[model samples]
Target: MNICRPYLAKLCSTLSGGPVVSGCRWVSNGPRFPFHSVKDIKNWDLDSDHQILPPPSTIFAPSKGRRTRHDNFLDFKRIRVTAGGGGDGSIAFSHSAVQPFGPPCGGNGGRGGNVYIMACKDITSLNGILNNYTAANGTMGSSNNMHGANGEDMVIRVPVGTLVRQVQAPIYASSTAAELGDDEGGVEAVGQDETENADEDEIDVEEQNEIYAEQMMRLLEKHFKFKTNYRPREDRARWLMERLPPKPYVPPPVLLDLTVHGEKHLIARGGRGGQGNPHFVTHEIKGPAICERGEKKEPVWLEFELKSIADAGLVGLPNAGKSTLLAAISNAHPKIAPYPFTTLNPYIGTIDYSDFWTMTLADIPGLVEGAHLNYGLGHQFLKHVERTKVLVYVVDLAGKEPWRDFEILQAELEAYKTGLTARPTLVVANKADLPRARSNMEEFQTKVQYPIVPISAKERRNITHLTGALRSIVEKAGAQG
Candidate 1:
């Protein structure tokens, strides 16, 4: 009849080497029970070696004959651009019948091409622009003092809210070493000397020479390894890897903010064309056959990042019915599954209220604990919610701790940016059709001060009421803004 009696009997049975308990397992010759106590059996390790098993190969291994599809929703891109070089000036003399060798008639060189980036609403990502872009060179000047044609400018189109920044070119070490072949000849000459000395004192001189040669080789190898592999550490690859600021590092000031559509920013300017030889044919130096060369073009590296803009955003933890509610309320077809973090990217959907009013709702990827510190999807997609006027908090009523989920979500938003929690918020209790949902909802209401709207997104129950409530909140927020 005693509560402790059953547990004591089970423990005695396990110690006596009877049948193994359901929760605990046996390891060979290591310990009677691997776990520390009976309460810790739930977190027991069955593997004797205690090595963690990796994910299945079918899930992690790359498949043959399959190509990864290009992601069109990329928010950031780094590109290297080389502008065209200016054309060389022409040096020629006029050969006319009336006046042969007429005043230095050489034409001027053409200007190099310029690179420009413009923001447009039609584009949604930077995937359309290739990694490397080279502009066309200008046409060379001709005889008879004909002016050279100017190069056509290159215009790159990107999505609105794109920011462009110029980055410094990386410096690399020279591939040719100053003392490359010095050790080769010395080693060969030493070997020859050792062979000659071996005949004189076969045992003593041979062993000494071999040992000296081995020590010399080791010293040379270490010296060369340090010089070739370690020195001049700032290579192109390493420079690129460190281009972005690390976590907790404040971002550098933006060079250009392309928030407006059709806004253009000149990232790289073209070199100016040189003056023709005719310009130098002055009174001091008449008929001078000298023509200047065009200036050289400079290299440019640009970083582009896109931030999405929406009227409202749905924020919640993973598998909290955010995607389901979004799909039910709007025309957006975001991927929805029972697994966590199903939606990897932000999905914007338009919600129409009546014929005149409509609002855009962004369904961002789920946020976990430490999201403000850049954990689990991180602050990458969190910026997309900054411009939202109204915030929708989605919670699963059938979850183990529905109220705690709401608090964690709010804490993440506040930590990311202040005044985020002060925005007009709407609380949604999803999955209300579940059996335990009603009881959990009652507990959630007593703990939370905000009004909650209970709706079953899967069954499309109470959807109309939820829509009306969200529309009212959004409209008020817009008016206040």
Candidate 2:
């Protein structure tokens, strides 16, 4: 007579292919168990009247350790946009005492919203566009030939080197109870087969039932515990639920690059408004009641990728003191650390050689051995180097292998993109104050063929000389271009 006893009995009966309990209906194809498959348990929505209850749990819970703020130097982003639909046209007539049947005075509908992507110098990252963008719809036309208000246009601002590409939106497939019901029928069939060989399959049927029951309970308990611990809100919960196993695959297409600042590209065009009844009042027909509806807005997806632009680029392996040299010669304040890969993003600084002449220098994150293969923040860091006309290879003299490090840096650059080694290059031997650095510098000078500048970045030794050499090289490169 216990409420739980009835549910358990029903479950055993369904699994054993036995007759259902009197006055009991199947909630689904199988027994009405609180915990089923991981997918099923999360989506389970029991009726309020059902007495036999499931353990308190939620199907959706937010993922742990999700970043709340946008990354300041994010180079890539995928955004979805929904342009507003055009407003409907009105078919109202003028109601005045002067002329009873005056001219047909229906108004035309307003145009829909448009989406534009613009490149700007002030913005450095795609972090500002974290949320999906949407535009407002136009207002409906009014009486007396009054046109509807046009929808507002949305302008998206990206970095100067950003490339915008149009891509198709991702489609998510939903799983239904009917799909899971197949498993129930299979279990029932197995149970019926076991009954035919009662004695031989008795233990097998019991074991199978126990295994399924344990699996169902374990999945329910795991998710239920997570839901209780995280206690995520609706939005976060939904985000987590969507990311559950079997993620969707969406491949974006390649599109044109937007490199110049103040450049504008139309990503989505607004829908056209429909004409009012007055437009249909032609010579052949009088007072036509026909009116067209506004066109529907089309949604679009865009991919934004940023590539930093600079006249000069500083490249080196991790912990090679690139940031220190950048701070010494330019006004940029990149994070200086003794650790590897400390600088996660690129920093741009301008050096003023004269009142009218100034050059921009970009300090990118350090590269590693397999940088070309996307190892150690390689792709993002190396991408910024592509825009630089001159390259300065910063090497740590104190590390005892400046030559090998320089070779590796050059190899990575060449591997990622050709013609980088052919560009005007300078070798800067940093950390010259160290005891062994002076000895290493002597060896580096004898082996390297390019111009070598030895200076202790920490002590600011010979920094002026290094900057002068860089300015001269930049000028020569500019003149050649």
Candidate 3:
């Protein structure tokens, strides 16, 4: 158990003219310097697991190449979740050498797995979620009356502040299947042409019963291919009990909002297992031969919408320097460019104050003039700011009409939602270093009613005053709420 590093110990022994301690190999550094200096210990083992690194020339490319694009950050997505199906019951009788014929000993099947959804703070986007999810199937029963094993349940974790809503639509599309109902699974009306063509109101009680009886006869024939004896009244009664269908899948009435971390909700429930042959043994009948079939769960469609939750939101038009302002204040690296529409998605950043207090902010994509009417990057990015306690507007002081841009920005927000502009707000006049910025700020101050703060984000000037003002507003909002 050598306490010193392998390279250090080797260096010590080399200088002192003493033998090196070979046992120090256990405490050596990994990957890069497993056995530090190959030339120092000149015995090169070519076939060892630790190989030498390639030359620096091969690692770095000489010429510049076109960059590859990455997938966009997804905040809204849809998924289909299907629960596992129940296992079928067994139909078998125990037989031993002592007794030629024994009583029925069939086992019942196991139920399917359930699906759950949970909210986690670690997850930030919906891009990782799958388009479809299917749970494991239950095992089949055995002849010795052993029950089947249940399927494994599935849990899906998503980011907090997610809204889950079940999509409303018909589970099945075929005319025959819809006529028979959702729980039938093609068994209620196997030959469904007559039932689908005729109107339900016109068909009386007697005609409906007659049509159902005919369908049930066809169902039995399809289920059993071989010739069997189900003619007796007792046998017929036992056979009908085994094919009972599961209940229909019903959608949730209200939308599910997961605001807190670690919150969970059941999205889909599995079907119940079928009954075995012995379960049908009544006083009138000594032994029942029929066994129930397992039930299959229908697939449900759901939509997940993730709305960002932050203390303040930065809103502006394209090339208005909102992204630049966010980068200067907080520890967030949002993409910045001179052209318009540089930010493709909303970016979140946290500002750590000196007193251990912190404020979170989101940089939303630029809003176009007709953004409320679905012109460009419409309400998609607008909803991300709905949960903020304050709104921060960043306007370009270098523009020809700075005050007109401010009024249009406020109008767009008001159009999206009725009272969105009524919250605590701040206006920022960015690019104060430009030639016309000083004169524009004076005219803009007179036209605008809100308090205006002038600062050059590119130069990183006067940021302390802006942050102090924001902290006071945030503190006031926190106290009132």
Candidate 4:
């Protein structure tokens, strides 16, 4: 038997009531022929397969804890986006050797880049999306009345069934108010000496952090909600050049969405270029030198959610042979185990027919009793089947009350959506090879209202008949849709 070094020392200490540290050296050298007490263990002869004095190892070691790993399949993401800013207008005079003092020749500023969102059919999730996006800024204007080049536009490609919406931004580490808003999960203490020595103008740390957060919010709304191409005129002075977020900037709500493949939507537009000083060169103002500055853009928040698209969906309770049936019918190699909750993510597989026609079937994670109330990631599992044309309920015929499972499944779907139960569906009675399955099916037939098809997914029996039935149901459902 293999034993650890720590275990030997503890055992020796408990046996002879001596210092365990001294006996630790007993395990350092080979175990030769013994002629004395426990101290003679170091002198014992060692061999390749020593029975009593083998090599020390950790095979029987003790540990404080164990860590369980979970695979991640990202389907939702929150991002912060910012559009590009406009270029500044230059002020230069056309000078020459003969005519030292010439007319104004400054160029106008260029417009900033824009942000676009597109739906693509290839992608299935938002795992590759970044948490932040910022468009390029426009170049500055120069002499010879040449306008600055516009910034490059960016396109964000998402899954075809993605839903996007603008929302409140999270607390950033760089913000001064992060101390109050961040989830630090710790208690704070204030010393009397420090508070008494501080000035009255120095606000309390909490109050200061709150004020900083409010100021940061106001600043973002003032800069990010810049929809206009050019800056608006100020009320105080009509003649002077003004900037965006006019004196009293009021924050407005913003959001958007795109669903169809190749569908595009503009999240933010670039700023407009400033006018040159020559534009003001009139009869009254002979030589104007004033120019406007380029407008700046700020960051905003957006959330992206993805839903799986398929022609048919398989639904059942945990360990109801859904994954097995999918693997037998299609080429999908999903995780299969004797325990419950083996399949954590939704998998889609394609089935091919003799005539080269193909069909897609999605294997969704198992649903629990309280699936409609969001138990055990129920909401996520249920949403993946919403886009399917047909639903296939796989029931475990080996169970004592198999018919009750069908009723529970129907109730969950009905609770999730008003008219979901009315959709076209098929009942699959799996595990027909098991003993008592036939008798159970007979009892199940009396309770259930729909027709049940008995089959053994492990043995692949009745799979052909099942596929033929699914083909007609899918065709009809697709035509109606």
Q: Whole-model Cα lDDT per candidate? A: 0.72, 0.73, 0.76, 0.73
Model 4: residue 116 alpha-carbon error in angstroms: 1.4
Candidate 2 residues lying further than 4 Å off, grouped into runs, are 1-71, 173-254
Which numbered prediction scores highest in lDDT against the true structure? 3
Per-residue lDDT over 1-481 for candidate 4, one digit per residue giving the tens place of the 0 to 100 score:
3557765675455334455566464332322322334454544444564424423341234554543221446678989888888877766678999978888777888888888889988776687788888888888778878888998998888987787887876756237455546322211212333345677577678875554444443433333222235332232122331223343232364444455789888887777666666665667556556455567676768898777778889999999999999999998888788888988888888899999888989998999999999998989888887887888989999997898898888898889877887888888999999997988988888887775789999999999999988898899988897
Q: Per-candidate TM vs. native?
A: 0.66, 0.68, 0.74, 0.69
Residues 1-481 of candidate 3: C-alpha lDDT, one tens digit per residue: 2323654565544333455556533332322222335453443332354432334353334655443221357889888888888777777788999966787677887888888899998887898899999887676666778888898999989988789988754455345446765323444544366667888787787876666665565554433221156533535633653644534557564378988899998888876666667776668656677666666787777899999888899999899999999999999888889999988788888888999899988898898899888778778888888988989999999999999999988999999999999999989899989999988988999999887888999999988988988888888888987
Better of 2 and 3 by lDDT: 3
Candidate 4's TM-score: 0.69
TM-score of 1: 0.66
Find the number of clashing residue pairs for candidate 2: 0
Worst 10-residue lDDT window for candidate 4 reads 182-191
Instruction: Rank all candidate structures by their TM-score, best first, as comma-separated numbers.
Output: 3, 4, 2, 1
At residue 125, candidate 2 shows an lDDT of 76
RMSD of each: 20.8, 22.5, 11.5, 12.9
Say what the RMSD of model 1 is.
20.8
- Please give the clash total of every predicted structure, in order: 0, 0, 0, 6
